[model samples]
Target: MPKTISFNDNWTFTKTDSPAYSRQTIVQGQPVTLPHTWNDSDGQGGAEAYYRGACWYQKVLTINAEDLSKRIYLEIGAAGNMGEVYINGQLAAESRCGYAMFRAALTPHLKQGDNLLAIKVDNSYNNEVYPLGADFTFYGGLYREVKLLVMDDIHFDVMDNSRDGVYLTQASSGEGVFRLDVRGRLVNEAAASANGRVLVQLKDHEGAVVWEDSQELAVADAAEFELSGSICNPVLWDGIEQPYLYTAEIRAIVQEQIVDTRQIEIGFRTVELTADQGVILNGKPIKINGVCRHQDFGGIGNAITKAHMELDMELIREVGANSIRLAHYQHDDYFYSLCDRYGLLVWAEIPYISFPSTLDPDSRNAFEQLELLIKQAYNHSSIYCWGVQNEITIAVETENTYRIIKELVAEARRLDPSRFVAQANINGVADDSIINTFTDLVGYNLYYGWYYGEIKDLGERLDDFHRTRPDKPVLVSEYGVDTNPNYHSYTPQVQDYTEEYQLLFHHNALETFKARPYVLGGYVWNMFDFGSANRKEGGEVGKNLKGLVTIDRSLKKDAFYLCKAYWSKSPFVHLAGRRFVNRHEQLNDLVVISNLQHIRVYLNGELLTEIKDGQPLNVIKAVRLILGDNHISVEGIDEQGERYTDEIMLRHVLESDSSYIYVKEEKTEHVVNWFERFDLSAPGQIEVKEGYYSIYDTIEQLYRNEAAKAVFLKYFAHVTDNPFFEVTQGVMSIEKMSQLVFYGIPPELLPVINRELNRIAK
Candidate 1:
């Protein structure tokens, strides 16, 4: 059998790029371990000042005299953006796609005693890369595992696109039997042909063989073989309930001697997406309780350990999530395995996100990355759909852009016909646009409550989409608001970044999704806060606080319990405003969230109210509190008669607490009420003049007219010069545009600019 060794230790890393390397040079560099990134701190510290250039990692390897005759290969789990591997200062292998595994044969370059292995990794701005522009920071390094494999002269092919060489396709063979077709490649590096027998065995979870087969084949340089096996009354890999898994062992035998062996964990299941019934798994309808996740940690950036991934999985499961959308890019392989074991449906994708790149007309990088993503993760049973792109039309939607997206969808289908292809469209894309019809399923990243419209608009908009495209299956891919735990409000509003508002938004969203059977369930925008270097909202810079859990994984916001109350079957009760203790209002609303049906509330040891057959959320409105400190307690009983309780102390203060509010730095004047500064003396003075331009006109219209263009530049030059302007030029009117990117413009000057544009003739 082949031997695999860890190559993650005793590595030296440096931010400097040097053409020469020696023992002294490697010793002089900072000593580091594998799964390391240089941008751990700066990447999360606001301002787009993180390092994004080439860095070098060097390691020394020693080979014994006896192992010189065997074949040696280096396997790299992943590298950010791009990487080049060098052995003894000689280029051996290179990979451009950052999220997939690749391997290089080091047999030819190896000598007896000692060898130097160096890797140059770069995460710089590359227009040719799939993620040309996105919201998350691209932390650069060898952010995954590295290993070395030693095998005999005849073994399974390690150069097959960095896959496991063995591919298994499974299907239901009627009468409770599952059939599996196994295909694999074998290579003989010796100077002659070799005859071998390939043995395949299927083992159950208890390590008992359920199926076995063997095939005899002749190989010259390389050859392929196919074999089939069947299992009777197999246990299905159900989602979350069972999550049963089987193991497959493949061995290459030459003349009655095992040369190489490979083992893989496999599962059998079936998934179907229907327009009317939503997702069906194992002949039963299942609503996808999903959450999207980013790979970075609080301070670790992208160079995270397997323990971190395990903790994330535990947290996600705790929140009663059955599915996870691995957003934008591919994640570590261990995460996929965890999903398989935990039975979490996965939506995996390449990072063909945000703006489409015209620099590469064919979208070659996009296609290549998709190929890598699909081929590398083909065997994992947790992944049900392949996401092609996310918000690609946000910047400019042209014929070329549409063509590239269509091709990507086609490529994804061609690569994995068994899985569904999906895309997440930006909010403004019309329902009838061709982009919505390019995939098997379509998801809209709508933020009605936070970004543009009222919270009630979410269900109405989804209803409109169902009426327009009844044949298409739809999901709400992303929807969230940034929340700061410190900010609290008795009467929450949009963009307040308060825990109360976050709870209100998700409560409404969850109810909306549950009410509509035609619409598939929604995935929360994020499970945890993440680093977005360009974001400066929610009283934090370089971070998007739209997560149920804090970025550091130290705190679970009140909204987390709201989701847990709805989805989890476990009996528990949670007080909604645990952090918002001090309040000025004499009469306040006390909220309780629990999975149990029977709930009771008490104030200062006095029974306040009781609810029987209650829903997940129960609100006791206008409860009068004492002048000083007051005690609130909620108790619930499940069907099993088990008791669950939660308690909190609220101080009824005489004066309002300023610390509960998010105080914005005075920006000359408060821009939020810019429209309030409009002259109301003349009732309808701001009305659009006929055949003339005004704030009501689209940005594209105003930019086309010379007179209106000059007026627009006079007062709003900063808006036109912003990168966001390109994303909204043709799609949004000036009045609506200002609502999104309203900064720097003085509140008092808005009416003057509108009046100036109102004077220009169309």
Candidate 2:
């Protein structure tokens, strides 16, 4: 049996000025733990930004005398961007990809006693490693677990970025029997020929060996072996219903002695995405209720533990989601294992995102990184598809771009012929684009309601795409609106940080998805808010507030219950606006989300109303609130007589109190054909004055600034006469225009905007 030890403790760390190797550098570092990032303080959000450069980590390995005969290797679960490892002043290995796992053989450098293990990690922006310019922050460090593997002279090949050098591919042949093909490589380090037998066993959760096979091989320094067999009456690894896993044990035998052994926990299942039937798992059709997730937590960037990953999965599963889209990059290996165990279907993709960089270096790095991802995560049954690229069409595609993408898809299929290939295209990709015709599965990251177009356009856009590519499976990969719990509007509009808008947006999107059979599924933009240092929009600075749950994972936005009511089988009722407590409106709509059939609501101990004709996910009714505090209660009963109840207290303040009062109605202008006209101008130059954005910046910041609005309105009034006001409104952000109106736009400024637009037209 092979043994492994934790190499996470007793490490010293220090920031370095350069990526060069030196013995004195390790001596000058400070003590730290295995999972440490230099960006813990400044990476999240600040004007200065975090340092993205080289860092050093060193540790002493005191080997036991008896263990020296064993082959030793250092396995890094993950390192940021690039890493160079050295043992006793000698370079062992170098890895460039930040998200994938890598390993180095330390057996040759290991002495009988103490050995020096040093690593230089550089997360500096590079042209080779992916995500050259992404939205989320990339924190640098040796941010994941490190392990030391000790094995016999003859062992399984663990040198490459593989799932321990052993891979099992299974397909449901017929009559519930699965044909399992197991293959693995063996290394005879002594360079001696030893006639060896590779023994493979399939054990159940009860530890009973259900199938066994052996392949005899004439072993050289390195050799390969494979075994084929059928498992009779095997328990299927069903999604969420029953995530049964089987253990595959591979052992190498020499002269009746077990030289080396490795065991892998695996699930046996078949996944298919069809145009007519949607996602089929194990011969049964199922809908994918999913969400996209980033790997960072609130304060602790990506240097998280298995416990943190488990907690995230648990939260996802509790939301009634049976699937997850691990967005933009390969996630932690342990998270994939949890997905297998918990029965969540996953769409695993690489960060070959945004667009192609330098074809020679960047494309090469992308292909290698993607290969590493597939190899290391091949055996996990949770992954049903491998994503090639995400939103790559956002930039202009060149001939090299098409060539590189084609190569990526080909490489992914060549490496793992069993999985489906998919890509998330930007919304701008037309129906006739060649990019859409390449993948087995394709999803569009379209924010129709929030970004530019009306909410009603989503259904038609998806229908048009399906009509164009009737053969390919389509998914609405990402769609959602941002919301700050503090902002609430009775009449919500786009870009308004209101919980109501998010709720309505999801309601509309889900209805559209439910109506379309050809659409496979949709993954909501985010499961939780994440840190983005440069972001300052939607009442949040340095954060993407589109998550169903807040950043801290403590508060679930109102939209969370809406999804739960739609996806979860568990019967429950939740009152919305639990966070938005103080209200100034005299009449408010009390919303209730439940998985039950009907809901009875009470306000201030009085039976307010009982709603039977409600949407599948939401129940809303207008309620009149008295002065001071009002207590609200709800009770719901499913058809099976399962009763669920919840309560919340809300305060009603008079509008005359005059401190952040609520508005029932506001003057709003819906800008039609805004982007169509805006795209005509190449972002026309407007001088940026000190401490301000361009002239158009009024759309983002001046909404609530009285003094600033006065300055801009006066400035616009002087530009031109009746500055084609209708054209100006149509050529800018409708949400921003609506904000300008709601907060107070001067009537004279409309003509000024019109005149300016007319001058630009001339």
Question: lDDT of each model, Cα atoms only?
Answer: 0.84, 0.78
lDDT of 1: 0.84
| Deviating ranges (above 4 Å) for candidate 1 | 21-28, 46-48, 668-762
lDDT of 2 at 471: 85
RMSD of candidates 1 onward, in order? 4.9, 8.7
Model 2 — TM-score against the truth? 0.86
- Highest lDDT, which number? 1
TM-score of each: 0.90, 0.86
Clashes of each: 0, 11
Q: What does candidate 2's lDDT look like per residue over 642-732, in tens digits?
A: 7789999988886533222233343223223222322233334333334443334422244345554454454433222322232232123
The model with the greatest TM-score is: 1
Looking at model 2, residue 463 earns an lDDT score of 87
